[model samples]
Target: MASRRIDVRAVSKDPTGQVLRALYAYASPDAGAPCTIEHDGRSIAAREGEPIALSLLGAGVDTLSRSVKFHRPRGPMCLRGNCEGCLVRVDGEPNRMACAAPARDGREVRSQNSFPSAQLDVLRVTDWFFPKQFDHHHLMVRYGTTINEVMQSFARKMAGLGTLPERPAEAPLPEEIDCDALVVGLGPVGLSVALALAGEGLSVCAVEEEPFAGGLVRDSLQWHSRDGERLCGAEASDRDLAKLRAAGVSVRLSASACATFDDGTIVIQSDRALWVRAKARVFTNGCHESVGAFGDNDLPGVYTARAAARALRYGVRVGESVLVCGDEDPALDALSDALSAVGAKVHRLTEGERLLEATGSSSVSGALVGRDERSAHKIKCDAIVASTSRTPAFELAGQAGVEAAQDLDRQCFASWADELGRTQRSDVFVAGSVAHGGRSPVRESAVARSVRDYVTKGRVR
Candidate 1:
């Protein structure tokens, strides 16, 4: 796994070239400011706003952390912060989400839950000892009550998080503010809701975890319209964001909504603490890309479709040869094309073909695909982009009293919402994949009408 940065000039003439250029413009030589971060005692160049996970991966340093019990290697599964696979210690802080944190010059980053190093953990013997399952209760029973104390002490030493800081860091004071409506996500649906509400003379506050506001729009190569016009996803998102700002919608980037209360209080965390009190809350947090359950799926070079797109957009070299396999969808097709445009040899598995396992040691070297349970073949490649259907991001909605049930047909959890995006709670609503469990036509007018009625009428229908 040698460190390598993809050459941006190779894809300069491609359609998605503008996206890669815009994403990595800050890291360019002409771009001012030297941003270099130290990881595992090695200095790596980084962009001002680029995620630390991408920077580390670009430097050929995968295996951000090790599994707690078996010490198995883990890398970034979802470029978004939904998955804990990319947890790392940053600047003496343990268990920090690398994918969510921006790389800062002079910052020290290290992997957690591994002795020696994440790539070569000595505690990996635990995997061999407990090959099938890891139940401490069962282990204790087998050893007898006499060894209880010894077992407890050994378990505490073996299975634990990173070491605590010698001195406690100062916590920032909380800032409180009030608004007419609070939008929890800044995706297309969330942006639309904010714009529509703000246009109606209501004060709005929208929060997004990502540094940018477009959500998936920023990752797509080109969006085709019914009128036969090809538009870049990032450009469209920027246009919409501008409209929201013009309408007086307060936007918070690189901020996460930590929690929501029944009393209409929303807690957000970024550089500081922000407590927002709003009359109505709208959740358009979208969905998380689902990873398939296969052997070595957590390998360093195995990426989800969303993660692969993010890596390419950031001009990170995922691999020279890649295997794209997932549920049959246009998004998968677009990602394959995008990877090929970026000079990577792209190979796609047939629809309905199941990925049995990712074959690799330190990094993915190939993928095993099969049409049936017994028949399978190996495809040689340096990387594997694997994904299944997306699961609705229902955590915020669930906190606000929305109900979610498993949708067996879709193979994901689906939230219950009316056509107008209204949930069980009168003050709460949902939109986009968070409401539908999958991609659907954006019901802009319907969501807008519902929000207006809720704000004006102040009652749940």
Candidate 2:
């Protein structure tokens, strides 16, 4: 039977989509020799020398395993290899992250603590039987004599969670890099800053936390040039991506902005920790989307506009119907565009009341959005996409004492900035949405250039 071709354009705005497409192309046996490792009863079609899970997700398998206690379905959450939400058993190993796990093609992936496949897991029966009882495993106490025996006799005992296989340990190594300017974030603004710096022949480094560059651009169809030209459609964006890479700027993909310091030092972690000493730094870290503060808002199928954009760009169709509501323009506009691009029937409310309730018990069936008075209406959808504006990724900036306030207009926290985009800290410069200077191609370039000139000329003195 012919396999269904998921719309790859859905996730085209996300940089990860490119990595996923590259991985799939490299790993498919039909294309060439599989690029993965093969072992006893375990084989992963490896590409890019990483685990199979990232590729699988890029190929559209977000729900790797179900929750242990509630038996609710779960997928990749913290892609940082930290959150155990995506845990699945590979070969003889138990409870490993699919995002961090490499796909070896022939490798056997099994559901832990559940019968049959992770998708159709029978252990979900526990949710029906023990409804409110959130117990995945029980606790236990060892037997003893005398006073210990007396306590043991009175107290009941249970066992803890099962163990995982031992892994080989090794000492870590240190690495370093030096650049004239380091732009953290590979979004449109980040790439723009890097390109601008490279145009001036400055040694610049652009770092993106995701496995691929381009940041959110891969999922978005709208691309703007400095002259205010709307570069929509997938092909133009891909061409732009190639141009960014062709520039002399060093693009660090799959790297994170781990931390920042007072002396213009930046720490990024990928396979290992990299200490970067740059003459100056620009943070285009962007904003966070808001989730509805209602019952079961964190359930599967519930996602932010950015996440929806990712899902579509990466061939991960949310569902047949989509519900989109938000406070701002870009997010709502983006979500609407992505959903329409992927053939999803969309019902949108730009500035409606708050989300009252998410209808379905499992997997979404519908949602309730308060209208006015008793006229609250129900928006039926398989997926809910929302944006409550965005907050500056200010953890690092907050450490530098960049002042922030709740903006009455956007109804979100924004940073206080001067005319030249320099923060209160004389050494630090802020750019992109991180500075809350409003989002636009022109504004971003102006802010980035101000900082670039400040760094290149030392004019702040």
Candidate 3:
């Protein structure tokens, strides 16, 4: 990680190189005004729109904090705000997710939960005390109730989410809104679902957590077919966004659809609360990458494949020498190639090989990979990029009465919809990667048609 990009764009001159250039052009974050932020009272230079965590990682400030109870080192794992590895105090706000917070000028960031500093925490001795494990609830239970209560208090004090915010948060203004269809997430599937519905003359409203549409499209290699010419996912996103706006679809960026009530009302949390009662709901919440299981996998420099690609897409190299380990997939292969095209030396762990551990002190330096523990060998790397099948983001869908069944292969629960993307609930439907075992949904058009029919035939009129 460095303060400047590696400038690999100039070196790539081939056709693949041209494709990389186009992708990088689209994947990169807007280089906003130069700004400086204070980390633990020290200044770090960063741009306005880049995430604080990325800025810190680029500055080589990896150890975000120690584990809550064990005090083991922790850092950014997913880099998508889904993991607790990147929690830090931002401008007096305790337990703020660094990846989710932008690096604005004059922003103050500090390591939370750690005793003295994140790097040199005296409280890490707590991990040494518990060679096996520490159970605060049963620590002094046999002694007396009072002693148990005191132990619990000490544990609470040590858990360290820091403190309350400096200022109270103002309550969000609430609004009651109705739409023909409400779509959650704006990834490829969500965008397509929304587009199809709007194309059919149904009023569409789509909500995405990220400020941008096209979730992993810009960072990862995905393409769309448009006008007989293949467009990269980012280009597709731009075109689709324009088309959506032209069709009067309200695409709400930076909005998160959090819950659905028993009365079929979906609660979308953004700048304002939207109690959206759509005639039909299209669940396209997409999915989140998993870090998988391995020893010391929580180390700072280890990242999910997509997360590493996202950092690179933002023009930040997680490491100069990267190790990628996982079963092969088209997206995973593209990302590894992208890493190499941008100057990182990548080593791909072959099939049947498994990661035994990620070896590092406070951050990842190498990964131990092999078919079995006995044959495991350490491969030197500053970053370990793990590629695994993503898990469907099915929590919000569950609130909409979408049944999720456990998939043993991916080792997670996935949203299951009928052949037509109809969930158990009539008013709610699921599409895209959220269904079909986290694969492509069966024809987004069918899902959109189902929603449009609901809108036209139901009580909406």
Candidate 4:
């Protein structure tokens, strides 16, 4: 496959130009510094405060890193940085998720889990020698006595880079947190739910994973209300955070909701562990970015597109030149502009059949972009921010044995419940993105109405 360079004829102005400007403004130097990444022959840079992966993608590097087992090509699957697919070596440390890492200039990156190159990996030969041995059925047939030792030795040899580094654990004192209605996530939908709940004088407890609030709003390319007013969730996020505080709603940033139990009891873990026994819980954890299955998808520089957007929000540069590959849509388009604003040469794979593999050594150097759906073309890049789709954050709900159904209209899985958000379990209720099919708006009013009805009617609908 011959590589293709950006054709001057294909150059076009970004459709999401206005929104990109706003995003860059929000992440300007006054807000913070810029982050940078080096790939191929260029250096991509974005403002500080944005996620490293987002900045890299914005600059147009779609293939951040490669996969491990098959040395198959890979990209960002989840945006919250939980999936190990987007791991990159930062400052010599292995397995740093580009999505979670705040971009900073001078940070060194190296791809992991491959030798010679991520795309042309020599270890892929192992796949040919023991193809059947890696399968689940083969592993299960053997008893532990004979196979355990053999497996352990093989595992030791096959174990690649990016092992989790050991760190000391810190424990904090327990505290009682109270709320009339508790909402998880700080995205637009979550904020809208909080606004509605707070307006009703219901004590709301909202938690966000970022150092700041805004959920997906921070990276929203641009969303227009029915009234036609442009709403960038960044400002709205700040206002929403302020309003929650003013309404006496407790807002916890950098906090994680570890679990939800029966009888409205929730466990939250942050720098400290705490318990919240609220009357009702509004689950708005939203969704994670979807990862791609390919050879060496675990290499450094391979990251999700959302991670690159985070780098832009934080005002950090991800790389010099980035390749943005994904289904053509406003979300992906916005990333191109964001990366360009921060100083990355952006490239987009608009044509659907252009499947390609990200290639590099130590770290990603470029990609083999398929041209016109036929043969492969090459794009010189340092990082690749590739994405497939988003998946709902239903871990807690799934574990609780909540009945989930696929909502084809929304391209996601949803659960059935009454108008007031009651489930089969009398005491359990769901709202926001988790209840709906992971839509952005997620019918904010619906969430509030359900919570309000439950609080007032005092019965499962």
Give all candidate RMSDs, comma-separated.
2.7, 7.0, 2.8, 6.7
lDDT per residue (tens digit) for residues 2-114 in model 4: 22112222234545555445554465445555456653324766546555665655554545555555554444445575765557776666677776766677666555676
lDDT of 2 at 81: 46
Over 1-461, each residue of candidate 1 has an lDDT whose tens digit, in order, gives 66646666656545645445444532343443548998887798876667899888888887888888888778887888877889889999888889988887888888778878887888888877888998886677667777877888888987778888645866788778788788988887788888888877788889898877888777665562423645566666777788889888888888788888976654556768788988888888888776778887878788888788778767775777999887776777877776776677888877677889889866788888898657899889888888787778898789888999675556678677877788888888888888854456347667766777788888655
Residue 4 lDDT in candidate 2: 17
Instruction: State each candidate's clash count.
Output: 0, 30, 0, 74
| TM-score for candidate 2 | 0.69
lDDT of 3 by residue, 1-461 (tens): 34535454454633465346544565444456779999988899887878888888878787887788788888888877788888899988888778888899999999888878888788888877888988776688999889888888888888667878898876776677778888888887888889899988988888887777887775566556777877776676777778777888988887777777755454545447777778788888878877788988888888887778767666777788898887576777777777777778888877788888999777888889999989899899988888777788888888777789786656778787876787778888888777745554578888877777777886221
lDDT value, candidate 4, whole model: 0.62
Better of 2 and 3 by lDDT: 3
Off by over 4 Å in 3: 1-5, 8-15, 18-24, 27-30, 141-153, 222-225, 264-271, 406-412, 437-440, 459-461
CA-lDDT, candidates in order: 0.78, 0.59, 0.77, 0.62
TM-score versus the correct structure, for each prediction: 0.91, 0.69, 0.91, 0.70
Give per-residue CA lDDT, model 2, range 31-95, as digits (tens).
32345443222343444434545444444344566765556666554343434556776665766
Model 2 segments beyond 4 Å from truth? 1-73, 76-104, 107-165, 169-172, 223-246, 263-269, 328-343, 349-354, 372-380, 439-461
Candidate 1 accuracy as lDDT: 0.78
